[model samples]
Target: MEKNFTIASLEFCLSQLKRADESVVRKAITSGDGLSESSDDVGQKLSEAHKNAVKQCLTNADKLATLHNQIDACDKVFERLQNMLCSFQNNLGTIGEDMKQLQVQSLDIHQELENRQKVRNELSQFVDDIVVPQPMITTIMDADPNERGFIEALHELHHKINLISSRGNGEAVAVNDTIPILENLKYKAIEKVREWLLLKIYQFRKPLSNYQIFQHQLLKCRFFYEFVLNHEPAIARELQDEYIDTISKMFFTYFKAYASRLFKLTMKDAASKEDSVGAIDTAKSSGISGFFAAKPQVRNRATVFSIGQRNGVLQSDFLGALIVPHAAAQNNQSFQFETLFRSLQLAFVDHYSHEYLFITDFFLVSENEALEIHSKAMARAVSVLLKCCEEQIVVNWDAISLHLCICLCDKFQQLLIEREVPDVNGYWETMSNILWTRFDQVMTNHNDSVRMIDLKKLQNQGALDARPHFIVRRYAELTSAHLTIAKSNGKEIGPKVGALLESSEDAIEQLLTRMSTMQTSHKNKHVFLINNYDLILGVIDDNESKQSRIYAIVHELEQKSIDDFVEVVLDPHIGFLIKFVTECEGLINQGHTQLLVRYNDKISTVITTFNQKWKQSIDAIHSEVMNLFTNFRLGTSILQTIFTKFVQYVQRFSKIIAHEVFSSNSACSEMINVHQIMLEIKKYKPVY
Candidate 1:
């Protein structure tokens, strides 16, 4: 029943209750029966209301049945919807699981694609870096040697070889498989380059071949040498040795022939025993008193030392253009000894420089190894040059010519250094030692000759001249030449210079001694000493700093000679005045004023004698000085010096007479004044 009570049944019950109330109210109003007879009346009214209420209940029952049917229909529909929702939830869970699986699979596919692409790229790169193509093999095997294609192929082949040799890729089977093939190709390439280089090297042996042009050609293919050296060092060594041997022998043979022919053109009479510095001879054949009394018109040929005349020889380039013509002409024409020596040295230097550059440029070698190679290649050639130089040095007795040869070596060595040639110092130094040793021997011979000179014979052979002796003049010129060479070369004067000077001094001393024995007068001995000493000093004046030792000695000797000359000339004329003044000064210095006073008459008489003889004394001194010194200027210089000393002595004597001996102005009146004496001396000053 509660289930049947729908909204329609509850509304029907409410309508029945409202209708009963309405009927009761109508009955009370229409009958006006106040309920005074209400017991029976009310019972009948209640029975009628009950009948209406029953009918309305039956109608409500029908509506409530219909509403219950609709409710049952809604309940069935809701249950079906709930079952459908549960099935859908289960289906959605399965779909979500499938979607998650699909997402994971998609991610795996993306990763696999990326890894495959990476592997493909790596494989492509590996093949590109490792594979050798057929074109490369063909090019290496059969291309022209001079073509760019062969070099490119060779580079590619070497790259593959390096990959096989490298630590990281050496164990790869693919890389290992190609090694044997690459090795054969490399060997074939090496042989091709080796044959080419050997052919070029052999061309140097051809006569009249231009080696510098050949060297330039080799330099263009220098990479071939590097290739051979890297692949097979033994083959490279063999090539280098072959080049050294071929070049050495070629240079040796060429230079030997060249030098032999060149030496024949040298002057046979370039130097003689008469050209020696210590060879002293008189000028008697020329009707002169001293050896150098008459200066030769051709001064270059006459002098014992005259390097200035051979400046062309010193500065010669000795080029093949100049040498070859002279060698081929084979005329009777000849050069000086120094000219020959310089030509040989310069030619050798030019060849050595070229050879050094070639060895270093074309060979793949260490610096020391390159030097060793160069030395070996030039060894025989160097021996030829040294041997030629040795013969020249040993056979030649001309000291100046030998010295010039030494200078040539120095100059050539410096030229090589300037040209950036490799070290060939051993050769130059060896040649220099040979030259200097021979020079030393020649100089020693000269010194010994001077020391062992026959003074008596020399005296008997020649008359004494006012000029320097010929031997002294020759010694002076030789010493001057030595100093000039030393100074120009920026070197110190050697010990031999000192020995030469000592020997020269001995010679001059002997000369003066001979002159003293020949002359009876003290004046002639002083004159001879002065002339020789002055000549030496004048000749070496340009090299004073380098020849300070010799310069100082000669200077001192010259001053002593002048002093002796002045004493001998002046003593006879004014000895009394000088002695008197000297004695009076001494007495005055000793507090002997009384002794000086007693000598007043003597002083007056001395003044009278000086006043009478001063002019004659100066004139006589001038005549004697002019007679003694061959050089007029030298005579004037000595005369001026004598006058200066005489004036000074006169000044002292006049002061002594005035202050010490003569007490009165009248007594001082007779004294000679210094100005008057200087005025008289000024008449004799030299013009030039």
Candidate 2:
């Protein structure tokens, strides 16, 4: 078959070569004819050769067909032999795989028998060794046996029982016979172990355990129950309950002992009987003093935990862990931490009240001392409030702020009423300044937060909610407290609020200066200053009572500040625009022959300059003011004011030109075309 295929391939190649050689010979003959300029005889010879080649191809085709049929017969036999060989090889591979599988089966059977025998031996050994040591039982019988020694022996027996049962190889049935014996030993040891555990609990010392005896011992006791009485559920429950009850007693004992110690360390004797009685009398007489008074409380015996000498007791990790399992298993919510928190709060108020009273009494000896105390107290209070806000504590921030402000007011007023305060104006001024500083801080912080917010994102979502403003809740509280103090003292907040207003003016001026320094192509500084002044005015306006004297003073101050700011900062730009228009009007009044053309060329430059400066200012003012204020609306009144004067100048110039035109020759004057001049002037009109 191989030889036949080679011969057929050679024959096909030879036929193709012969055709290629004939084609080359014909091409050569045509080239020769063209070169020689041959006639019809050469063409006849070429036609004859083509006819002969066609006949030869027909003969070759018939021969190739015969050869192809013979090669096909040999190929069939070759293919049959190849198929037979493949089948034989496949059969051999199948037989080899069967033998390998049979070997594996035989090995598995042998391993199974061996494993069975080994398991039987292990089971026999487990059955034989399934008994506790006799000495451990004897030790339980002994009067003063080693407690730890007995525990170790029982642990060994428990370990062995677990090891054997966990095999699940039918050796667990062997332990059925050992259960009664183990139970009997456990029953005998229970009383002794309970007594020993109770003794250990009672003997625990606070200094050594750090009040965590119960937590430290719980794990050991749990392990003991799990190992010793694991098979006896009822007995385990009874023992655990007893252990917990004993723990409860120990907990109380430790708590009480610690409480007593703390009370001894903290308690102080009354320095004078008269002072003590006077303090009580003052608390009762003065409404403000009661807030600072230390009061007694009757304990609630029903509460499992109560506020006492230290907060650490209630916050102990052991107590929390101990209560978790109980809380989880309870049918009802019996635990109420809020009650404990409340108790602690009341007790804390009392404790701190006394401490605060004592400290203030020392400072109250002199006016200077009192002022010092007042400064330090207010500073600390503001610091703590800011810290609480930063930490995001869940507290009534507004209420606490109000209470603190009220307390400050009361403290100052009481001192004044008693005629003990020195430098009355100094006291109130210092307070007003402190409060203003705090207000400024709050506003600054709020502004920073507002700046970070995604304003564009919020606007796009249509969730602007009127553009939320920075909250100044404490500002209201502090102001109200200030007014209340002022009213009680029969004083006015003219100087106090006047000081704050000055501070506000300085801050606005600084901001405007900064915007100018940046040299941005925006004109919003004036607007920003205006809006900030307006916001400050709004605060006063929001709380102002027309009938009140302080409100009147504040209103007057705010109005004056706004008017002054506008004149000093904003009027210059408006005046410049006015001057430029006045100069243009003067040129128009002269009415030269080519006056309008010259004016258009000159004023175009002026208008460009004016718009650049004006637009820059406007942009700066708008951007900064919007950042400071919420839902701000601006008017084109400034633009209108600027343009109105220019409109007057243009109208007056037009009227003069019209009069001149009408007075001249009617035919020649019509050709002047004044409307073109008006259109050129209109090109310089301000879009703003």
Computed on alpha carbons, the lDDT of every model, listed in order, comes to 0.76, 0.43
Which number leads on TM-score? Answer: 1
Q: After superposition, how far is residue 425 of candidate 1 from its true place, in Å?
A: 5.9
lDDT of 1 at 421: 79
TM-score of each: 0.75, 0.28
lDDT leader: 1
Q: How do the residues 1-688 of candidate 1 rate in per-residue lDDT, one tens digit apiece?
A: 6757766676875586477677766776688776546547767888999988988878698888899999999999999999999999999999999999999999999999999999999777666656778898798788876788887887777777775576355656776666677888899899888888899899988997887787888898788888888898999999899889999999999888878877777665665545655555543445444455554233233434655655445443433334663534555577767777776777788888888877887896777888899899989998888897788678777767776677777777778888987758488889888887888777777666665667666667664655687767767777777666666555676676557556666665665666655654777778888988888877777745434687887788789889988878889999998788789889888998887767866766787888899999999988988887878778888988999889888888877866834766365686777898899888888766
Worst 10-residue lDDT window for candidate 1 reads 295-304
Angstrom error at residue 268, model 2 = 15
Task: Give RMSD (Å) of candidate 2 vs. truth.
Answer: 29.5
- Candidate 2 lDDT trough over 10 residues, lowest sum: 273-282
lDDT of 1 at 627: 81
What ranges in model 1 sit over 4 Å off? 1-130, 167-173, 281-303, 309-322, 325-333, 411-422, 455-463, 496-502, 543-547, 585-598, 659-668
